[model samples]
Target: MRDSAAGVLLGLACGDALGRPVEFQQTASIQRRHGRVTEMLANGAHGQPAGTITDDTKMALCIAQSLVESGSFDPDDVAGRFVEWYQSGPFDIGILTSTILRRLRNGDAWDEAGIDEWKHLPEGSNAGNGSVMRCAPYGIAFAGEPDALVTASRVSSAITHADPRCQWGCVILNATLAGLLAGEKQPLTSALELAADAPAELRTACEAVLSIMEGSESATDLELANSGYVVTTLQAGLYHGLTAESVEDAIVEAVMLGGDTDTIAAVAGAVAGARFGASELPDRWLRAIDETAEIRELGQQLDTMEISFPESIVEKLSSGQFDLQA
Candidate 1:
């Protein structure tokens, strides 16, 4: 469990840093320029050094730090840490995330900020991958605690992405991660089974991954639709993360999908890392990212920490506000 937990964080950082250089490039463009992005190259989308992480890993680190410090799912303290990160003026925050964080900085309550911003956006544009990308920590922290993991996943996402799809997206991803951490034989399927109330779009995404794994669905990169939408990211990330033969292969395949490279790969990396364990991650990739050590330490701390959900969150879970399959 400890090794797999550490793998989740290290793999997330590896994907973020590796894909940072070619983030939005089309598959053709990335192939033309770099052949295959196996190494962390500098000066691409963000113009930073090699192995530099973007908002995906950065925001996740904030959540990890908050979890380790509070030893629980304290949304208030997590919000404060996010505000601190936003104040740092990161170069690659998502549009919805930036607006919500701006609201947070201006004294809007953490829970209210995302809900208000989500209210004004149209359906198609409302849900982004921002929340899901930073949610893997909860998977490790609450590996055997399904109810607390589900509540934490949804609430954490609601702080920045209030759409049901966005909220459930985090639930499905972390639930799957928790399954992997516990050494389940079919982690993705287990996650889907637990998400009895998940949106059809999210359900279909998980089903598609199952099909691909079973040799009944297409697994091509074009079919992955490397977009920033929550459903698309979830599908692509799970396909690669759960299907790849190796940790390095999962991340590389995700980057090869092109659009939203860092985020898709980060999600895939976390899942793949859980499956393969941190020792299976490439040493070269591990040494490149600056946050590798800290992420590893946080993962260890999370695995060893005793979980205690806050009273309010526990009541909400008990009230069936966010029901999951028993």
Candidate 2:
């Protein structure tokens, strides 16, 4: 239970790296080539090392570090860190995230950066799983305060993603993970009910998640969409995570769904991690993630964060007075 933070973070990285090699392959190909992909293997999508994680874990690490440093949701700091990471050249990055960050680099303010970008992109491409994939750190840091969790999740998402589904995607995920960390017996349900203020689209996707968990809708029947679309990814990821019997099986099943495999598995891994503590996560999977030690350390730091929210930051966030230089 106490290891929920480390479990969620490390679980995400493990899932990302495990699925890295076979990201775009169909379920049949995955089953035929490697039934139950349990170990980290090299030469898949990006042709990196066996334990190499993609941008999902890397961006999460950035968010975790910013939260620890600021002791709150510092949107500016988070934005700057993302810009820095983008400049450093990550191997894998979502299209929306890259577009928004590039605009940020070109002098768009943190608060204003994503608005225009989101406006130009059409529906299917606008709401991507980018924000949701890296938002677990906010859940860990704000595990005690649901209101603050929602605010942080939504605001930080504007650093790159501004769509309601994208923004509420983070809200739903972080809220659920926060509840799990707080030891809610029915964490996901608690989160959904608590997030009643979230957009209806988010609720619809979340209802799909429950349907999967209730065993009434088969994964195949539920139309497990593994695309980068936020709603589909959320549905499929949570379906696999909440429905599977074990952590390994959950991650494997999500990745086996094919497209957007790493991100889907990352999201599923976080949900499964909350359900089963860090102790339940396989040592082999942990060892396989190259940043395992960093993930554990960062998760611990976030878990123990003594929240000291000042009125000034809240005012700035609420009034839309975010400082890009902060």
Candidate 3:
């Protein structure tokens, strides 16, 4: 459990740093400049400093902190944390998210803040990967219980993202975390199957992602899976999860896939970290990350939290009670 949590934190930081340099680059541009971007660089395509994490890592840590504080999923408290983090100001925040969070901080009711339509913005226009990037903690916090993982994921995601795709992405990520914590080694196909019995909304999304995964080849899988929301980003991460042989490979593949690279890598990193543990993380990468102590502390706190599910559930999952549906 400690290793899993540590892997989660370390994986998050590593992905953040790795993708920070190339967050907005196109596939061709990235290939031209970095040639597959296998190693972490000090600056991205736009020359952003190395180790710079975008809103994805910032929001993810906020979720982790909230989990440590509450010992369970609490959307209200998580929302409050999001508001505070935004007020404190970070280097990067999606425009839609920034607008919504600002309204939340300025006394708008959490439910109503983001619902109003802006000038050119549609009422429910968000299809970003914001939700999936920060969703790793939900999986780690509610490790074994399928129902709880789904519930927490939905609630956590709905704070900023309301699209079905976003919600589905959270479900897939949570299930991947569950499978890894349970010590399963099968590809994401088995993980999605374990989660197929989730609520109807999430089940459909999982099935969509599964179909995409089944027909995709290694080179074009990332292109097939959009990364704008929970579903697509989760699908992209799962593709990497299926093909990657190491934590490093998983993150690199996620980032190289292009389009929301940081977030895809972040989600993939969390899953790979859980499966491989902190020991599997490359030592040089670990040493180069910023905020190593804070990340480590957060992981330790999460590790100390009591497991919320029953022992039977944990054992059933750990023993591979579910069959692979793919």
How do the candidates rank by TM-score, highest first?
Answer: 1, 2, 3
lDDT tens digits, residues 1-326, model 2? 55878889987987899889999888888889988788888897998988899999999999999888888777788899999999999889988888889988998888887876777887777888899999999898888887788778887876788887877888888878888787776567877887786678778878877766666665566777778888888877777777789888889888888888899999999988887877788898887776788888888889886854456767876676753221
lDDT of 3 by residue, 103-126 (tens): 788888654554342324553455
Give one clash count per candidate, in the order shown: 0, 0, 6
Worst 10 residues of 1 by lDDT: 317-326
Tell me how far the alpha carbon of residue 134 in candidate 3 is from the true structure, in angstroms, after superposition. Answer: 0.2
Measured by TM-score, the strongest candidate is: 1
lDDT of each: 0.89, 0.83, 0.70
TM-scores of all predicted structures: 0.95, 0.93, 0.82
Higher-lDDT candidate among 1 and 2?
A: 1
Question: Which residue runs does candidate 3 get wrong by more than 4 Å?
Answer: 45-47, 114-124, 187-229, 307-326
Full-model lDDT, candidate 2 = 0.83
The TM-score between candidate 1 and the true structure equals 0.95
- Measured by lDDT, the strongest candidate is 1
- Between prediction 2 and prediction 3, which has the larger TM-score? 2
Error of 1 at 42 (Å): 0.7
Query: How displaced is residue 33 in candidate 3, in Å?
Result: 0.9
Clash count for candidate 2 is 0
Error of 1 at 159 (Å): 0.3
